[model samples]
Target: MAISKPAVPPRIPCQQCPLRPRPSFRDFTEDELDFVASFKVAETPAEPGMAIMVEGERNPSLYTVLSGWGFRYKILEDGRRQILNYVLPGDMIGLQGNVMKEMQHSVEALTRMTLCTFERERFPQLFRSQPTLAFDITWIAAREESMLDEHLLSVGRRSAYERAAYLLAFLDARAQAAVASHTELRQLPLTQQHVADTLGLSLVHTNKTLRKLMDQGLVRWLDRGCEIIDAAGLYRAAEWRPPKEGARPFI
Candidate 1:
């Protein structure tokens, strides 16, 4: 938690939040919005590479990402890290921390990020007063689990080409939805090591596989990241078909 910056008033209030009008996000009722506005404790910032939460730490607050990107990972005793999932706008983190004695994974920001913080103790109030919102939160957890299931399958069963293609396509699709209304498509901010850790592949293997993708024009590597050049092509190569989804809930 490197948010040593001074506290400041929230620039974007819940009512005028930029993400609300985007087609990717489910709409909130006036009452629900009001409650959410009150639910927020503060808006906090996390710089790139900052640890938002660490494994085995007890976090006092939960977070809803308001902007930018982050990833969840778990490190083994020997220092090897396995990325669990990518976090984007509207994703709620620290829920597990609230439920368990300590967090099982660590989260690190990939870009300068803003997060809406909520008191962990206030979670019970939401469940008691807002059944609908509680269900929405449950749905988010279920969806994350489903995504992890697919990743487990990929790591265990898929080929190198298939894994690389699927990973890029998946990130592209999710980024498109998460960054709604942005004029340009959001380029993924991922390094080869990031993909390797996520896919359970060696760094060299990840490089060769991504090179194959670049050769075929499916993706292009940038300074410390890569951009999805042809999403449909990558999807076809991976033989992955993600289920279509409409606007989904975000707290």
Candidate 2:
């Protein structure tokens, strides 16, 4: 319902996709590149807080985030929402809806976002002709599942301090990978409410835990987001380390 039909932004051809050139991503072959260019139908923008996809809806289009951030979530009848995971540029969305009959969860933009839309009907053709790109799509889904696995660990077993530390450290590492420049560090673009929702903690508890980290010089809470001041310290506090990922595939 939140999808808007404003004038399209100047589309970036798949051959010149900025995210493709990032070291974190693997380069596509010429054939794969050409297929992607055709697969993409248009470029669209979603404003902050817009609902990109809703539960139980069948979406005809898929999207790859061109810029900015979003989060996947599910809501209950009583209005309780659970934040599933945050999405970054180059991440594919609407796949769950495309593959299944309807969306099981919802997606909402956390910041102004640019997204490359793909025709859903052509998705099967890629799998039939381009096995490698099909594998890339599978890999992307697996990676998302892996993130959910870790979140499960945090919420099910980790303590409040450990949860806060692990969440920030994990997000910082993910942001670094998604960004084009490794040297240009940025904030997590998250508020305490987002943190609490994601971690399954109360807002007051989330604030208290964040304050504790700030006191230890592990992280800083800005007005709109969070900054990891000492990633190593946070890792130590959380007793966790990020995985050493090689160049990952994206679609």
Candidate 3:
């Protein structure tokens, strides 16, 4: 008799999953929640590296990152690629589609992903009908712009050590915001390839820099995630400073 392989598990719906427990629903009023529910659909499952939207394509949907990391990238005619950004849970990925209709870059899943997709027609309607959501999206876009500006600094001026240090500090801050503790660091889902693409550094150099961080007693990369051992030391190496103005708030 031939041996049979085990069946692959079916993907879990976002509602059923424990990871994304509707963090934003309470932020909406009952009427607002109803309106959003009418426009939003159940989660769309995506495989790792699946391209959700391609450059120059006529995009008709805007997505919320229900649970996963995604890469936004643009390609040059000569085939060189630059990763524009990474979007995490609760982040909006395709808001540009709402206005531009034609996407300037492609969005790909960095892991097995679930996205809450909304029709372009209904998405903009929410902005007009729901002023709160409009401001929320506006703030989100502005935050993305600020992050892009920081990336420009990292690529243009920061050395490899500074680049790696900056990323560590930034990741630590993100985890603190969500979990409310600077001592606790979130698991970094990024691989060396992802870091290299995002930071405009070669993969070999990125790996070397990460190892140097470990040697310097700034961070320890365990099996699950990186532990930030010395937060102040890391920030000092990166020349990081808090914004003079407050960071743009996003829901």
Candidate 4:
């Protein structure tokens, strides 16, 4: 897995950020936007399967997903990997690196991705000067924690079929919120192996669960992805309802 500095930095002026105007995303004031624009260091690009940040490394920067998909995960001594969560567009990555001296988990790209880098040292200044931005950062962290809690509940207590249904509905809702374009909602970039790791099931078990969902017309497996056929059906099967969320800030 390789990480490279963008040869030609992608100009992502905060004022023109595509996510800022979306109802799912909060708008930034000119002053706040200007601060963020200046705070941004550069664009970093990662190819599919590249490790953006490694476990136990002391990374100097934090990042926001400018585009594409990635995931947070941890590997055990036995090399068993557990995918903690998906990182979609506008999601923050490496916030833990700022609080802890070393990263406790790793982040890897699932698709070709671009990330907006921010020097970790400037985070304190941001908090002191931009209270609203600081609050948004806290909100993002809380949201991540909430999702983790739900994932824990699903893996620990739910039946395999219910777990599979919850995961599909969760990802479908998150992916739909992240993209402005409706066409992107039809498919998610996930494989059976990713599903297995996330759901804490063996690959065989994951496939069986997914096949059942497909048979019920809840979802369909693509060559390298999954398509949600009936999101409501999946939610019903899981007995889950997504919490209402406010416009989220894109840091």
Best by lDDT: 4
**lDDT (Cα, tens digit) per residue for candidate 1, span 91-146:** 98888986789999999999999999999899899999999899999988988888
| 2 or 3, greater by TM-score | 2
Task: Estimate candidate 2's alpha-carbon lDDT, on a 0 to 1 scale.
Answer: 0.88
Q: Residue by residue across 1-251, what tens digits does model 3's lDDT show?
A: 78876454454443343433333232445665566667775458778889998999987777877666678999899977778877766678788876786998999997777777777776658777889867777878887888789988888898988888887687666545433433354456667777777778888998899999989888877753467788888888777776443433233
Q: List the residue pairs that clash in candidate 3.
A: none
Candidate 4 per-residue lDDT over residues 1-251, each given as its tens digit? 68978569658787788777777888788899999999999888889999999999999998999899999999999999999999999999999998888999999999999898999999999999999999999999999999999999989999888889889888888887887567645788989999999999999999998999999998889999998888788889878786778878878
Provide the global lDDT of candidate 3 against the true structure.
0.71
lDDT of 3 at 161: 81
* Model 4: residues with Cα > 4 Å off, grouped in runs: 1-6
lDDT of 3 at 62: 77
At residue 10, candidate 2 shows an lDDT of: 70
Give Cα-based local distance difference scores for all models: 0.88, 0.88, 0.71, 0.89
Query: By the lDDT metric, which is better: model 1 or model 3?
Result: 1
Candidate 3 segments whose C-alpha is farther than 4 A from its true place: 1-26, 175-185, 221-232, 242-251
**Total clashes, candidate 1?**
0
Clash number for candidate 4: 0
